[model samples]
Target: MIWKEILIRYGELSTKGRNKKDFINRLRANIRHLFSDIAPLEIVSERDRMHIKIENDEQYEVLMKKLPTVFGIQSFSPVAVCSKELDDMKKLSLIIMEQFKEQEITFKVEVRRSDKTFPLESHEIQREIGGHVLRNNPNISVQVKKPDVELRIEVRQDAIYMMAQIIQGAGGMPVGSNGKSLLMLSGGIDSPVAGYLLMKRGVRLEAIHFFSPPYTSDNSLEKVKVLANELTKFGANIRLHVIPFTEIQVLIKDRVPSNTIMTTTRRMMMRIADKLREEIGALGIVTGESLGQVASQTLESLTAINDVSNTPILRPLIAFDKLEIIDIAEQIGTYETSIQPFEDCCTIFTPANPKTKPKVEKVTYYESFTEFDELIERAVRNREVYKFPEVNQVKDKFEGLL
Candidate 1:
């Protein structure tokens, strides 16, 4: 009488050759984790497709809204199951076509018979269901080339499944399928977008933020937390490491030359991130550096900063233009929060004239005057970690009072 199941079709996982099963298993786990709160449901994953059965109407409505955001799914549809009888098929087909009774539309009926022992063939079943619906609804017409609406019916050993709508899914490999990385997340529009791009490619993320107190307010730290929480919707939980950078920033401003201070600051951040990456077992470091967007993102400047670490540096927005990055930021819902008037550590002691192209030898020579290894180690040791989709402890504290 109503839809009782959801059918999921695979996207890139089908072409993985021998690794298809592992990818499917990972996707199944991710879906289970995403829907852990919704109970009384069954998820059955097959070689070509997956099916989730739900008995409650409210839960079915929730699935419809959440299934589209899940990666690794090419498309999905709500399915109505019925007994294998000619009269039942006809009645269900008529009920499905009743929605378009008021408007003129072109429609087609497609059927797949997994059970070949059925009395009618695929074509015969299509004609039977198609004819029944055509006779009942005068506003509907048949167009085999490309119909406005397509009703797909599948026959199996257990029952018959019917679906009339197919919704598009977020197509990519599931998050955490590739590997884990450390993202240098700042309170900026581009870094959050960069983390999102890596997550789409199946990379699990742990974010690192540099907080300089007095120079950076508590609201700045909260802004970074908000960005990390926004990213959790696209993948698994993110562990955010907030490094104390006030000492390092003050030291750089005092010892390093004004023209090349930006380069030294960036290199220090990379060194800290690389150390944290090794401690946490992350394979690479991710940043939102767009080429030529600012002085520090140029080829020469990037090379000077990258010399501090041997880890693979991933810059997803390297070739992207500023407008392009902003467009993606808006699409993923992080644009508004990133535009808040809060200063990060990177902006506090910024020089009016920074080196757009500085040699690695010269920057390294300037940084050698100050002993940074001790401070770098100290910053990493005193870092604070926060987990995203943070649990609300305030509600628990007031439970007894209420």
Candidate 2:
């Protein structure tokens, strides 16, 4: 029988041993949810490997596209499965080698004999399959190290699978394995990468973006939503909160010193973010801040801003350099969307010569210049909420994002 399946490989989850079943089940659920629209016939997982069977050939490309974004998967491959016996595997190996038979190139046959009760050892099976493939096509030569084609045979208890290629996956802990956090997702390179890093560590996220509608266009808010959508591909759903921030920016500028506005603005943002954390039942608030990267990101500046924080603050990119953060942004598929010219609330209300060494007491004294508590409450109360789901946007809710 000609059977089509995709083989999935995982990384650190293999080390879980007795607890591995829980991790495997979580990863399996993540894969199923992310590819809910693709609709595979069944996802059969055993030991450290998973095999996804499809009913039609058309689902191949769709499944391939979704697999790369599913965390906990180290790699995957499309395969043709056959019976567990030796002759059946050799016959299948010969057919699998036909794709490379057209070109005169170096190749290797690798065998993973999991069931040792069979007649041949791993190297013996490789030699036998290699000889059989070469006899059918003289154009193929042998190479041990690296080759144009590496035909693989996996001997499992139930069946033997054959494939010639492997595709890389996102490679991280399953999202939701860890608790959730509130991501301060700005329309910039660092925040998205920060969210990506936290997601890699298994932290699920709900993002909050501040938008000044008249000062910043709806197009800019849409850009932020696009970045949020890019993140959901990494095995987590993002419920985005868009806050009306023009009033806050104007108040900070009107009542605060020009040099201290950046620090004061961030303090208010932290306050609002902390409130969001409590309201949404998040463990902490995460940001893209790097040390001395900007006026507000300085150690002293961060301390002053975080003074008003009621919840813990997590800055994953705190020590990362610009290029390092950019590298992760590109790797996680959010760099292009982040680089879009649409500006965000953070870019508004220019503060020339902003305070890099802001003190909490001084920031407190500055806030005393105006009554700001009512406005922070107003911003949070007027916020719009959106949930980006894994499938069926209408039923699962991707409000305002569609």
| Top lDDT model | 1
Residues 1-402, model 1: lDDT tens digits: 388899999978888888898889888888887777687568899998899988887778888888887888999999988899999988888877777788899999998889888889999998999988888888999999899889899998998889888899888889899899999999999999999999888899999999999999888888898899888877478999999999999999999999999999999999999999999999999999999999999999999999999999999999999999999999888998888878899898999999999999999999999999999999999999999767663322213321
Per-residue lDDT tens digits for candidate 2, residues 154-178, read 8877788789877888888888877
lDDT of 1 at 57: 79
Error of 1 at 84 (Å): 1.3
Candidate 1 off by > 4 Å: 98-104, 392-402
TM-score of 2: 0.89
Pairs that clash in candidate 2: none
Model 2 RMSD in angstroms? 3.7
All-Cα superposition RMSD per candidate: 3.6, 3.7
Native-to-model Cα distance after best TM-score fit, residue 146 in candidate 1, in Å: 3.4
TM-score of each: 0.94, 0.89
